[model samples]
Target: MEDTTQYFDKYEENLQREILKMCSSLGMLDGELLASEDIDFKWKEWAPEYIAVALPEVNNYPDFAIACAGYAGMAAAHWWDEDWGRHHSAEFDSLLGPRGFDDMDEHIVQKILGLTLDSVEAKQIMNILLCCAQKASTFIRHEQIEHQTVKAFHIFARTVKVMFRTGAALELKRLGYKFQKVDLNRQLPS
Candidate 1:
């Protein structure tokens, strides 16, 4: 039997491959996201949430994966709102197709939690879950494994969470959302 770490490691590697592929397909360099004096995005903020959603004991794995992905989408939206130039960029719509996917992370969660989509406020929520879900579908798939067990699903859940995070980061990059360092000391007037 393959060690659990080894098993999940494969998923991690493939995920990185896909992420790089996504960046290339979108004509964006992965280097732009690397740390520098100007970058200010703190990815560690989502760690606690990831632990809850991915590591929780669950009765259903697919649902777990879906829920984890949704959480990721919503978290990504939070970061999206931090910038002044948020909606000005057309990257997400162009890449994800059409419109309505701008805040899809939140939309998907709203949808799964039984929120009504008929309200005037929800009119923009439709037709978005699938596109983002599709982006993560490949990561959650479990074909190569010889046996489909609860263990595999758990890994899938973790994979789903990570893939969604990565996708969001890529989208944010494409949308021109960079984390600019805010040096409080520098901003203080003498």
Candidate 2:
């Protein structure tokens, strides 16, 4: 895996920062999310690779997109643990919707948190996800002529990663968790 962040342009970096801030504003940044810091940007490296692996399981664009969402959900499941690929063929097999993604995120949140996904929060997050998806798709189509490389795919993958993590962060906020910040420049008590 590469430190793919180095490849991100200004707009992509700004978009990434805003989405993450939205997570914090919505109060989705929790221990589970923070725990992933040890990973740094590893998810950025693995998310797009999962896209190629997911080709056989999906039939169209929506399914492919949802599959990436599921990949993000699974990452949230184990604190973005080892990139063991997706559990698409494992226990999460049941969560896949026949024609679309469905409530593909149900199992992980329900099983782990014992809380249901709030419809309102889902709607808000869905809006953000859709926006991110559109940008990614646009990049893929328009980028091939210029970059002529996989940079577009990497950007799209990072979008997928942020979208799902935003969902988890929303859930964490719904569960009453908030992101805490440290004062790096605080003076110690004398």
Candidate 3:
């Protein structure tokens, strides 16, 4: 992935910064890199790449591919981890519609994530997420204007959040890290 952030306008950059801030506010950025520290601008670069890999056969399917990945990520999180409980935002649920949340424990999404990561390293995954973010940013902007809602924005946030966590888990699996089920209340600090 090349340095794609150079192509992002001031609003786009600010949007990315807002995401990092959201992560921090939600306690999701405990040990993760801040947006400013993204010196290589990997986040936005990987967003489109993720779309490509998700729907390679479709020539112009970025939106569909992104929605698919986002839905899959949401489903996979619950399937992969017993303690993984999403806050279940009503707005996000409405945006995804009835069919999207119907297949939370499905195998197809898991397979997609596995296949997507099968040929990549950590840096590659980071790039993929960044690129995915870029596409999501565009989708959010367009949807916001066309529909006058922020559901598109939440979709981007929740999707990227899941993707980042899933990517980290996949990388740890690649590094021979063992995953053990734990009680959330009984967890120890890293």
Candidate 3 structure quality by residue, lDDT tens digits, 1-190: 1343342343345544554454445433432432221211233443444433443422354444443443444333333342323422212232233354333213233432333334444234434445545556564555444332344333444445444444343333333445346888886879
State the local distance difference test value for candidate 3. 0.40
Residue lDDT tens for model 1, 68-102: 44334433543454552552232322212122333
Error of 3 at 95 (Å): 23
**Which candidate achieves the best lDDT against the true structure?**
2
Tens digits of lDDT, candidate 2, 7-62: 55543555556656645554445323442442334444444454554433433564
- 73: Cα error in model 1, Å: 4.0
Comparing candidate 1 with candidate 2, which one achieves the higher TM-score?
2
**lDDT order of candidates, top first:** 2, 1, 3
- Give every collision pair in model 1: 40-179
Show model 3 residue runs off by greater than 4 Å. 1-12, 34-49, 52-139, 142-190
TM-score of 3: 0.28
State the number of backbone clashes in model 3. Answer: 13
Q: Looking at candidate 1, what is the lDDT of residue 161?
A: 48
Model 2 local distance difference test score: 0.47
Q: Regarding TM-score, does 1 or 3 come out ahead?
A: 1
